[model samples]
Target: MSPEEKPGGPPPPPPQAGRCRGARPQQQQQQPRRGGLLSEIRTAIRSEPFHLRYRLSPGRELGRGKFAVVKKCIQKDTEKEFAAKFMRKRRKGQDCRMEIIHEIAVLELAQCNPWVINLHEVYETATEMILVLEYAAGGEIFDQCVAEREEAFKEKDVKRLMKQILEGVSFLHRNNVVHLDLKPQNILLTSKSPLGDIKIVDFGLSRIMKSSEELREIMGTPEYVAPEILSYDPISTATDMWSIGVLAYVMLTGISPFLGDDKQETFLNISQMNVSYSGEDFDLISESAVDFIKTLLVKKPEDRATAEECLQHPWLEQSDEPISRAWNESAGGESSDVTQQDADSASEKSVDAEKTEEDESIVTEELIVVASYTLGQCRQSEKEKATEQKAISKRFKFEEPLLQEIPGEFIY
Candidate 1:
């Protein structure tokens, strides 16, 4: 059989166009054999103008999703690294294209603001739509805080990041946009120093709200989801505010105020604002910061502080005096006790050096493609697995409004 009909790899290249339709003369018997055809076929595929138009730069896969892959890519023309999302076309009966279109359209509309990850460009081929977006190097605020475990950022650092997040949300709200999902994962850092610079990313679930309309969709990560969202009530900027509070709580204490082993349990805990903070680990957190969290975690969406209001809150105010004086005396300096131990033992110092190297490697990799997670790579079971693995549990007494799921009739 002709190599063109072969089943493996790409089909062999078709014969060149200059052959006669009818059988050629005896001179045609001198035609080339098809054994060398595979190279030609591969060349054609690679040489297609569509493929030649862009070079896929080297970037480790940041994340894998069910329908797409998030890769860190640099635009050859601009030399600026961006997150390139490669989404495969749906098979016979699926309509993922529409979902992609919606995300792109919403992002395009919202890209006017600096807080949103700018959707730089969208390119389509027969099989995929490539979405290029700005890359935030410092990685997800979620991972950063979680990595801190017992010792996340101090109260002032938390306040600084929270204020910036609030400002970003306020900007979106003023533009009549609602980022239905506002968790720590969507918050990113552009800088890594003590003073962090943040930018909001991931608009996969963002929606533009009409001035007169209120949304009633239950979207967003469960822990940070607002009360109204769980109840199916109309959502507004308040929903985002609730999420901000959850983020603040997590960043300061390395523990969520809402505890649940699963989505159902987590939702329940969030509804009641049931929470516990480990003083042993979070001694550095200030009372004002904790109070702000209590106010925002109130089950009633109407009672929750708005982003603008949050910015005006006294706890968020800038002060020259250190809020945590202990931090001033102890934060990140040469400790004689620790140094003495390291110096006294060669093995101990070597181990410390190795750990530092590993940590630095992790940070370097994480900074390059923080936006590589695409929804297509996510599997239902895998998502459930992640939830199970990160399960947190505890309960606390509450004396305020409790969240309840809204009935369908009143949800909108």
Candidate 2:
């Protein structure tokens, strides 16, 4: 199911977002969420009335949400390409113009960072909202993470991703925007020239906080969510840093550190802040990098390093030099030449097909148990919220998910 097809809100289940494959099996048709950032901008664009800006030749559906759909659009006059994210103006008997305003405000505020997605133009109708945006061609980085490669990503690759994420997220923090949801699906990669560069996206669950305010909300996916969120306590910028730690762990090891067999267990692990790098997974990983993750994964948000402090960490600032070739070769390194040495059955891949089911983005078989548990929890929570609340709040709603947690694209 695509994010749009899901009832709870857009799930950020990133499709196999590599270059937007032209042919997709009917069962594999769910495309990436252009993740929720694309839909966020579209929802935001509907806030204002504008002249017919451009003719939209909708291509493949980039992302989906309850009320929005993002597609590749082209400028009628100049023939330039852009993402046209369409959204309904009203839903559940409520006028959502205010929602559009909020989305645009965040997009404009975060535009200064190159790693953030750009809102290009806006158009509106009585029933729909259309937003033109800078297209992200490479798609999400999830496919590679789940690939059969002996390694998910090298230390150098992880550093590259984390550095860009930290820099961009730092910018968001400086501006007071708290990205309540930070996960792979919400993170997209640029096309061609910059290839694998990271783009921090999906503002659906993000909030702009007052310097003195204590932001608190039951938002964010299970695995990547900060413990503070679990307790329904106040939130801070550190919430995002916690997610970064989870992201770093997954990127480097292709496995989630704190995930468990059920929501209760997953939440239990998070509450305990228990993580392991002692396994074979960390044997090849650097102590400095592990230390970096440990610093961010602390039980107390105050104990977690700030984004700026993370940038200063030796693992991120110094020579990446890549984790040893043996590690990369085992995990699946950048060098195609090395992949040839592997057994025929284990061809070097960006994602391990065996682990993921068709378009379902769960990264590894090891993750299925934990990931499925999170999904079950998210669904139950969604149902509970629906029946319990007079009206469901979009705050807890996923920006884009085909599943819950990580739409959470295997892990939010």
Model-by-model lDDT, in order?
0.54, 0.60
For candidate 1, lDDT tens digit of each residue in 1-412?
A: 1222122334211222212235232222112212110111101112133334456666467444445666777766667777777766663445445445545554544444455566766777777777777777766665555442223355667777887787667766654556666666667777555545777765555655544555567666666788788788887777777878887876765455675655678788777767665443345556677778877877787898877678778788856235441222356422233433444564454677775664443211111112223111111111122233343122111111122221000000
- Considering every candidate listed, which one attains the maximal lDDT? 2
Q: Please give, for residues 1-412, the per-residue lDDT of candidate 2 as tens digits.
A: 2222222333222222111234332233321122223222222333444424455564556666566677776676788877776767676666765555556556655554677787776777778767677877766665445544432456787788888898778767765567877876667777533447887766656665554556556777777788998898888889999999988877776566676655566789889867777654566778898899988998888889998889889988788675642345445433333433443334345356642432242112111212212221111111223243322221112223223222221211
Model 1 vs. true fold: TM: 0.65
Model 1 stretches astray by more than 4 angstroms: 1-53, 88-93, 149-151, 193-196, 211-214, 320-412
- Single out the weakest 10-residue window by summed lDDT for candidate 2: 373-382
Candidate 2 TM-score, true structure as reference: 0.68
All candidates: CA RMSD in angstroms?
19.0, 14.7
Considering every candidate listed, which one attains the maximal TM-score? 2
